[model samples]
Target: MLTETYQQPLLDSIRVIDHPEAVRRFFGLLKELIDIVNLPNGDARLVFSPSRREKGVISADINFFQALRIQRPPHRRTGRGEVEYHLTVKKSCQERLASIEELVFEPITEKSDYVAVIIGQSNAHLLTHITLRSCWEDCLLELVESNKRGPHSARHNSDVYRAAEDEALLSDLIRLADDPTLAERGQNGTTVEEPEADYETESASAQQPHNLILFGPPGTGKTFALQPYLQDGNASLITFHPSYSYEEFVEGIRPEVLGNQITYRIRKGIFHKACMSAIQLAGYGTLADCLNDTPENRHRRLRKAPAHYLLIDEVNRANVASVFGDLITLLEADKRLGAENELWLTLPYSQERFGVPMNLFVVGTMNTTDRSIALLDIALRRRFSFREMVPDPGVLPIIDGIDLPQLLRTINERIEYLLDRDHQIGHAYLTNVTNQADLCDTFRDRIIPLLQEYFFNDWSKIQLVLGDNPSWGKDPEQRLIWVRKKYTASATTRLFGEIPESVDEIVTYEINPHLHRSEYDQLPVETFIRIYQKPTL
Candidate 1:
């Protein structure tokens, strides 16, 4: 056993590893290992001790490796003085281990003592290697059986080793060990299964909150990306604007006319209604099944319920802090109903205790042009996983000798330079353009009006974005934004027989009317191509 004096130094040495996330995960994994392998007589201090020969390296004791024990040399120091953790694997496991780049097996001696070590550059590389190693479960079971047959077998007979028997615990430890985010979740005393690749068929075992926010510029397919999760009848969509309030999101009071007299009644809002639907789908008898039951009992009663989704569009338009209220904390995966840190709140309107169910997933969309993610409420940002939906020009096809992809890309690049990436145009605007007529109509209706708003009708900047230069003397019909310079000095003299000295030449801009006129059919393909092409010197 390490003395109290030595323990602090060992922790200090581990803390100097440079990556805070990796350090956190190391401590979490250490606690789990101690719980699993350190018997009543066994000391957990043996798991990590100061190295006698190496200055920076902490000698991770071999006893801690009972579940996945290898030969004596548990760790080796590189020339740079960094420690590399390794384990000895059986021949069968070695063949399966070859596919993993992080786990490499090499000969340590003249005999068959080959050890595998993680050489990846990631901070949690060592921890990830141990959990993801091949045949780990088999080795763990073998260790348990071996301990039963040992000389001091009575020490291993207690419930201390009972956790090793749980398949769910073993699977979760292996699956979640690599994620740094899981370390944060460990603080709340809960473990969640990894989310499935297909959300529609997501497993009921996953305890992580499925809160996702898709954000990007307008017309970037933020809403379209949510289609897959909405195929079933379990999904509902709602839009938020500046006037959106918590009263409409959660439970609130509403005025109802009863026999010519106004009466105020408690009404369930969209979020409250969604929670009720999710609880019912999870096989609960009533809302009381969640509010009154303990977390453990709720966990046992939870069935393989169908997932319920609430899609919030234009999420950033409303004041999220005021809208979510105290329920924001309940949105965390570990704070959901039946979770380890389960929380409940009494509604002010109905006075009913309510909790967010794990089966309910919240997905939101934000238009970054309207609101940048940096300005979002910190509480809301922490609760949701954000996925960016930037424009992809490659998805646009060529139309009638015009490179629609390049045209869109060029315009966005200029827009990004003039304003910011959040104001750039999305490729979806050109996805439907199949011919010159379709392209003309798109620019006349959607593209031109969008640019006008984006640049605040600054004709010169808009002209530059549309590939027009005032000095080039380009044909007026060829330009998307036709510029007409009006000498205010001369205009004022003609109107009132007096010229104001303050009035100088002013440039007026308008979208070419010919784009929508009958002459559009006669317009050449060069009109669109020139938007992306370089001008001749």
Candidate 2:
């Protein structure tokens, strides 16, 4: 959730403002600042650029040279109700100048240690923890002279920023610990059963790393969402797909050539990495952390390191046996490292425990559109709750241009017509198509090709949704191609006014080709790109 964005300060400023409807103007200005700088932290100084027009040219005015002083609460929620803080700006009209609260420290040259203007004001205002460059101490002399408020004022040098971070973390922990639906009525549900068990890092739920499932199809934003959970704790991500053998997912014998000698190395596959990560996180150090780099000896130092998650991308592609290997016992929710649960498989190398560690969550994603995925074992299917990651119709209305509200209704009607007869195109595919190109081009090339892949038996489905009567071909495959090509042409014409004369005329390109495309093979790629997109152990 840590965004590499310059809008942090502007957004933070917006959050400090409590009024509801009035915040709209503030939000617009904040977004304007974001677009102007484009830089992560808005490195541009508070320059007095009054001469520039506010059209396409972007710039900031000097607000800091003058100062404004006021007082506010330690923690105020944004309109969305998240805890935050803002600057206390008070400008006396008679004085003809604005003054700000005293800054915590000052700014300097180091990028890592300091970001002037925004960061300087942030430390002085919200956090007060002043992460500063080496020159901050010397540069702060200016603030001391101008600041109307005293250096040690309760508002200045406050620990409110650190306190806010801690508060947010605790709040999230509380939300995760109690299954909100299971809370007893009349009870202060926020009041935890064990106040000491604040961090789920040591909780029973965190051990069941297998309880989760990565729900998005390829490029459905699944990995992007999973990264926060991975970075939040000691976690590992294992991607599963057809041809991802047990040898690749679990432990396997890796052949080594030593001169004339043939050596067998017990190479740890993705599962080995996941387990080792889990064990190290459970309190046990990693094999590399404690022992030598030889993979054969890694099994020697295996212990609990309290893992938090084991994300399995496209899990349905691989056999459950290969994916889980010998770690079934650690994955069950009831079974934990210390606490006992229903007897099942014994861990091969760790302490006596059945089921994944209580803190370990197994999150996997599956694409139901893949007919071959029907090969998924019923037993594994029964264990996981499969929530479809289809694009919500609500999102379509939010998309700008082309009468999306009307387009959405048409999409639903077509989808309903398809689903009523056993055909169901995923919403994720639609969203992906919609996201391609600009507002004009999206309706033209991007969505049409994808819509062709909708897999509907009813020809009318295309006819109703596609606006004009689709020039569906006589054959099914031909019809699908016709749809793709027609839509591509329409979208292109809408975007660029007409199809390009040559490759150079094309305005834009896309990187994520639909996974449904079969032309991409013979190269060992998915394992690295979509699979290992997650950080390693």
Give the top-scoring candidate (TM-score).
1
Candidate 1 lowest-lDDT run of ten? 153-162
* Per-residue lDDT of candidate 2, residues 318-358 (tens digit): 66765566555445554433334422353343332233333
**Model 1, 1-537: lDDT tens per residue?**
112243334334443443334333433444454433322212222334444443333333333332321111224533243334444444457766676655655553445323444442242355555445435433432333232222321112111121122333323333333343554565312242223232233463255347989999988899897786665446667999998888989967776543346756565677876776677555453577666776676754443455778889999999988999989999998788877777888888778788888778999999998989999888889999999999999999997899988898999999999999999888888888888999898888898888889888888898888887655445556787776656567676887798765665777776776775746866777777888886575
Each prediction's TM-score versus the true structure: 0.60, 0.42
| Poorly placed runs, candidate 2 (over 4 Å) | 1-209, 214-221, 286-307, 325-330, 342-355, 371-375, 396-401, 419-440, 443-446, 456-461, 470-537
Worst 10 residues of 2 by lDDT: 153-162
